[model samples]
Target: MSAELPQPSTTSLADRVKNILIQPKDEWGRIDAEPATVAGIYKSYVVPLAAIGPVAGLIGMTVFGVRVFGLSYRPSFGATLSTAVAGYIAALIGVYVLAMILNALAPNFGGQKSEVQAMKVAAYSCTASWVAGIFQLIPALAWLAILGLYSLYLLWLGAPRLMRVPQDKAATYTIVTIVAAIVLFFLVGLVASSVTSMFMPRMPLPGGTLSVG
Candidate 1:
């Protein structure tokens, strides 16, 4: 009988998040070598982290409400819930699609294509944005969520390392990948907004009426 190979160790989600956020350069190295299935990554990491934004947004919009031009407007529960759910689903799909794009573009950048590595890059790079979702809990502080743009920097650092892209071409690769992701998410947002608007209710304001959704 042959001996079984040792199983790779798993890090707790908190530790993984801390490491990736604090020391991403080192963390990406571990992530590259870690044995992980796509489903495992999604279930353990992506699903929970991605929920932070949508859930927080739902609570913020319904409870704290949105303030614009000294007027406050609260969206209906149904509209808020539907938008949250749609956004959450879109985020999940976005990550998978991003990984595919990364893998497909590898050859153009002189990189080796590995689906698993691409997935790791896609999921881990989003850690900053997902964690920043906490800012969405307070409508007033929602603008802080822009801090999630740090994810782009994380991707720039991780892509060449994990995808084996040539150092000289890493910047171009990251830029192209980012542009593609932006277009994908923009389209997803338009669709989600259109669908969710059907549930929105009109709110009466001082000067006019507004719809919050």
Candidate 2:
């Protein structure tokens, strides 16, 4: 068996986030060298970033309020809190699901299969999107969350080093993984929305209290 990739003695979270955005090539090299476990990766990276969107959304929607399709709206505090917690948990699970899908699909895409490596790629490549999620703080700027598109580039660069995909197969691998992730997320969101709706209190609408979004 090969030697383990050494974990850095002091990898600052802020520095890692900055490096991944500003210096991804070098950053991915560093990430590819670091040893990690599924749980460790969640504690170190996924858990924190996953909260960015929901936390920001909670504050923005509840405290500051925002226009929904040009109509002023604010989710009740209870609704916001429940939604935030549910979304945060969903985000964490989404990463793990994506990692599993990536690992399972690797061999079919001319990539060496390794679940640990796939998890790392799934966790780190998502940094851009999680960071972009902060735009949730300002609903108007939420469209800028499209910046997560940058992750596609990050994944393309990291695939060969992290997932061991051949250069020619990297694009195919990335595209496949991304598509799978989108579908998985959509399903997760649908389920979460359904569940949230079932328990969430209805708010007064133009005419009466109706539980609708």
Candidate 3:
């Protein structure tokens, strides 16, 4: 058998988050050189961070409730909890799917594909968006999560280096990958919603049943 690859150093999660968000160019360089495994990345980074949005949104909706047309409506706890769990699972699957897309499309954009490298790009580039999930704590402020669009900028910078794409083609690569991700997540959302609805009980509201958006 071949020799084992060196394991990545134990970098604190907070430091990694700060570096990726504050100085992604430098962070990408480190990410490209480090040895990482799919399990390690998911356990150390993706699992925890990806939970932020779903968990926060769960608390926001169930605790504070949603107000529409000067009326307050709260979804049933079972529905809210189930939706949160489904969304969280979807996020975990989404990252892996995105990495696959990045690796598959790498050669088309003049980049050499490496699964680990694609994963690093996919996982780390999402730091901004995951961090921004804190906005979900207050439904009204959830719109501020738009700031997470910075992840697109991070993807633009990291893809060329990690995927070995030429700078000239990086923009196209990033855009295509993003479009693919949108479609993938959209489908995933539909499936999750459909499945959740099948098991979710109908909750009566003042005028209608509580809808989990």
Candidate 4:
């Protein structure tokens, strides 16, 4: 039997986060050089960062309260809790799925295919959006979460380095991956919302109003 290869200690989350956000052009090669497994990547990178979105959303909707149509209403603690759990799981799974999609489509884009490289690209390139998720802590600034769009640029920049796409084809590959990611986000959001609604009781709005949220 062949001996198993040892995995490198995963890179520090802070350094990885900092470099990816501050100097992505240089970070992709460093990230690709790291010896890591898909499981290690998820455990070390995806889980902690992905939690930012749901945790912040919970705090915003339940603790900070949402302003809908000029009225403030809070999702009950139970709804918030359930949604957070569902959202966290969805985020994790979404990364894995996107990684798979990226790897599968690499040939069409004239990129080299490697599952581990795809996972690295998918997870790290997402750092901006995951960090921007903190904006959800304030219900009003939630719109600022759009800043997460910066991840798209990160993805575009990293595609050539991580996936080995020709510079000519890099933009097309990144754009396609982005469109797929958007669809995945929508599907995950719809499922999390449905799950939340199922557990949520009718919330009472101000002035004797009952909202079937």
Off by over 4 Å in 2: 1-9, 192-213
RMSD of 1: 3.9
lDDT of 2: 0.79
Model 2, residue 178: displacement in angstroms?
Answer: 2.0
lDDT measured at residue 61 in model 1 versus the true structure, 0 to 100: 82
Q: Which segments of model 3 are wrong by more than 4 Å?
A: 189-213
Q: How close to the true structure is residue 174 of candidate 2, measured as C-alpha lDDT? A: 82
**Per-residue alpha-carbon lDDT of candidate 3 for residues 1-213, written as tens digits (9 for 90 to 100):** 998975964779999999999988898998888899877898899999999998998899777777666655676777778788888898899889989999999999999988888989989988888899889899899999988889878888887799999988888988998888778867977977786665453445343244444
- Pairs in steric clash, model 3: none
What is the TM-score (0 to 1) of candidate 3?
0.87
Model 4, residue pairs in steric clash: none
Expressed as tens digits, the lDDT of each residue in 1-213 for candidate 1 is: 996653443899999999999999999999888887777888889999999999999998877766777666776676788889988998899889989999999899999998878988999998998999889899899889889988888888888789999999988998999888778768877877776666553444343235444
Give the Å shift of residue 39 in candidate 3: 1.4
lDDT of 2 by residue, 1-213 (tens): 998764632678999889988999999888877777777888888899889988988887665564544445555677678778888888888889888988898888788888778888888888998899899888778799899878778777776678888887878888887788778878987977875675443443242222324
* lDDT of candidate 4 over 1-213, digit per residue (tens): 997774865668898899888998888878877788888888888999999989999887776665666666666677678888998998899889889888988889899999888998889888998999999998788889899988888877876678888888888888898888888778977988788767553565232232334
Candidate 2, residue 31: Cα displacement in angstroms equals 0.9
Question: In candidate 4, how many Å is residue 17 off?
Answer: 0.9
Candidate 3 displacement at residue 61 in angstroms: 1.5
